[model samples]
Target: MEKFTTLTGVAAPLPIVNVDTDMIIPKQFLKTIKRTGLGASLFYEQRFNEDGSENEDFILNKPAYRNAKILVAGDNFGCGSSREHAPWALQDFGITCVISTSFADIFYNNCFKNGILPIVVSPEELEKLMDDASRGSNATLTVDLEAEEIRGPDGGRIPFKIDAFRRHCLLNGLDDIGLTMQKSEAIQGYEGRMSENRPWV
Candidate 1:
């Protein structure tokens, strides 16, 4: 996981709601446990046609949004099956944040774990960001985790709430494994004492 202190990047507008795990990673691409390559297949069914060609109509295929690091989507984003791969693909595709009116609980939690900021705000605020994102490459948004705000290109700032613990983890780049590693010395000492006291084992 990477440290996510602040990000200022292109914001792609995805107006669709209920973007499920299947549309995100797809079933066929689930065979591999790796996370990197999935970016190419993100939104597999919607991004590419049956002939494996880019679907020009999709927001991601547009030239301006091809390098989008953020997405402004409709309500109920990331609904459906509980697949961690959804966040993996989003992160792999360089999306550091997703702003929506609402998001599925599981997917929202998963975003924090994967270094992605899933922001939920009022529908009015979301629409404003969506409008800003419609301006193509100029749809620049600044997400400052420390400030807990999303700044738009039109000089508007919207505040968002995030768990303090999750904010700490993302700021320092600490995942579950990274959290455990913080106590490595204590763990090593415990193991040494156990070995010394129980030689037979």
Candidate 2:
């Protein structure tokens, strides 16, 4: 996990709704448990043709969006299956922030764990962001997690809200494993006391 205090980069517009986990990385690419290689397969079906050639129509494959670091998507983003690999694939593709009107609960949670920021905004706000993302080479948006706001290319700002604890975790780069490590001293002390008090066992 990496700290996510602020992010500013090109935002790719993905206006399709109900984008599920399978649509993101596809089932064929799930053979590997590792997270590194999934980026190449992100949105595999939409990004490639039957013969495995690149699809020129997909937003991600377009010249201006190939290196997009943020995504402005439609409603119900990440809707199906609770696959952690979806966020992994998105993060691997250099997209650390996702702005949508709404997101599936499981996928939203998974984003935070993987150091990706999943933002929920109003339908009106999403429309604005999507318009900004349509600017091709100039589709830049700055996400300031600490300020809970998004700054668009034209200098317009949209505010958002998130759980305070999740914000803290992302700011400090603390995943579940990192959170547990914070209690290592207390855990060690308890184990030592238990060993001495119950040696016969």
TM-score of each: 0.97, 0.97
Q: Taking the candidates one at a time, how many backbone clashes does each contain?
A: 0, 0
Q: Clashing residue pairs, candidate 1?
A: none
Give lDDT tens digits, candidate 2, residues 12-76: 99999999999988888878889898999999999999999999999999999999999999899
Give the Å error, residue 125, model 1. Answer: 0.5
**Ten-residue segment with the worst summed lDDT in candidate 2?**
24-33
Q: How much lDDT does candidate 2 score?
A: 0.93
lDDT of each: 0.92, 0.93
On residues 2-120, what C-alpha lDDT tens digit does candidate 1 reach at each position? 99999999999999888888888898888888878889989989998999999999999999999999999988999999989999999999998999989999999999989999998
* Lowest summed lDDT window (length 10), candidate 1: 29-38
Task: Kindly report which residue stretches of model 1 are placed more than 4 angstroms away from their true locations once superposed.
Answer: none
lDDT of 1 at 84: 91
